[model samples]
Target: MKPKKILLMGVSGSGKSLIGSLIAQRLAVPFYDGDDYHPEKNVKKMRQGIPLSDADRQGWLRTLNRLFVNNDEVVIACSALKNEYRETLRQNNEDMIIVFLRGDFDTIWSRHKQRTDHYFNGEDMLKSQFETLVEPTLDEAIFIDITHNAEDVVNAVMRALQN
Candidate 1:
């Protein structure tokens, strides 16, 4: 069966929100951007170009986990940069589908530069995310290259989930 909970994870600017929303729309499920759930303090830090520490993100991660626990089905876009963070998210949602949006620093950095509205757009912040990232293996999650066009990337994820 297809997974009920879907998580799109990667470094900042890896198109998690964009692709996750599309996937959720196609599936007729709710879409949640993990960024929106962050506390104001975290938002302020990121807006000021400060990288958040793990402790700063723990509460936010737990909140997202609670969202997952309460929802029947959802598509969530979160960085999930570290293995421990992903574990926290998986607390009660072991069957969740995780899609790792893979892209190089330069590719994601270029995308980050195009954004003017997001709080997490600094180069240093993006670099820190990459440094913190612990990518999942093939056995752990479906991986999609962000170099592809949006529609194609979504299609790839759909196909991957079917198997």
Candidate 2:
């Protein structure tokens, strides 16, 4: 089967990386972490518990668009919280398939607390992520409930793609 580009999106600590990795592996494609594309200034701001403005993210989104343009098949993990951000990516590549990792606040908070090395603190930015999220409707993207195991989530996404 030909590989497809998949964008795994959600708030911080929502298992985008884990699930995206599994999906990419299953599809035999590369997986890119959108965080890795962020400018140093943006990373620094997040490290300082400062939320990034749309201006702060514009460059990053453009970078992501470049990656999508360059690759024929890949998986990307991005905290595409807003509708506009997702729309920006979609505009760059109409064939892009977005997999939204939807989870409740408590679930994400618990996962955040378990993470140690990441720059974002669950308590400090959870509210901001939640507030920024304009939940994608059925018409917007493929939604996956992330209240289960990572393997299950990946399986669900794959099944959805097949149908």
Candidate 3:
């Protein structure tokens, strides 16, 4: 199969990075972390448990778009919580395929609570992420329920792509 650009998108603690890395490795493509593209100010605000406004995210999304522009085949892990953010990315690269990782709030919250050294805390930001999530409609993009193991999730996506 030819490698294609993919966006692994979901809220924090939903395992976007973990799954994206595995998928990228399987596809022999480079993987980028969208968090690394965030401006220092945005990082600081999130570190302080503050939700960022759209203005704060605009530059970050553009940075992600640049990565796609430069790479032929890549997988990116991002908390693309809103439709506008996804649309901006698509505008930059129409071939970009969004892989929406859908997980229940409790599952993500427990995962977040177990993590250490991350900027986002589940208690402070989970609600905001859930609120921001505009679950992709059938005609919008590929959506996957992430209630299974990581490998299983990846396999499911791979199988879906094959069809």
Candidate 4:
């Protein structure tokens, strides 16, 4: 069956929000940018260049997970950088299809440098995310390289979901 619950995951600057929103629009589903759900304290910490500890994210992850539970179909762009975080999101939403947007640090950093209006755009925070990333294998997710243009990337995700 075509997946109705999709989570686009990666470190910041990997285009999760852009690709996820496009995929959701194509599928006629709702799109939720996980960044929007973060607690204000977390945002403040990130804005000050502090890396969030797992404790800081527990409530936030659960909140995002509820979005999955409450919706029949949803596309969420989240930086589920750790396996535990992904597990938190999958609690009652086992059918969720995770799309890992893969890209090297240099490629993502180049993109990050161009962003001007986000609280989590620090180079150190991006590096911290990479360090915390527990990449899901092919069995765990549909991996899409983020070097492609946004349209191409979304097309790739759509094709993967068709399978």
Q: Each candidate: how many clashes?
A: 0, 0, 0, 0
Candidate ranking (TM-score, best to worst): 4, 1, 2, 3
lDDT of 3 by residue, 14-115 (tens): 889899999999899999999888999998998988988889999999889889889989999998888899888877688888888889999999888899
True-structure lDDT of candidate 3: 0.87
lDDT of each: 0.93, 0.88, 0.87, 0.94
lDDT per residue as tens, model 2, 22-130: 8988898999999999999998999988988999999999889788878999999999988899877876588888889999999999999899889776476888999
lDDT: worst 10-residue window of model 1 = 116-125
Candidate order by decreasing lDDT: 4, 1, 2, 3
Kindly list the per-residue Cα lDDT of model 1 for residues 1-163, writing each as its tens digit: 7679999999989999999999999999999999999999999999999999999999999999998999999999999988899999999899888999999999999988889888885788888898989999888889999999999999999999888
Q: Which one wins by TM-score: 1 or 3? A: 1
Model 4 stretches astray by more than 4 angstroms: none
Worst 10 residues of 2 by lDDT: 1-10
After TM-score superposition, the amount by which residue 45's alpha carbon in candidate 4 deviates from its true location, in angstroms, is 0.3
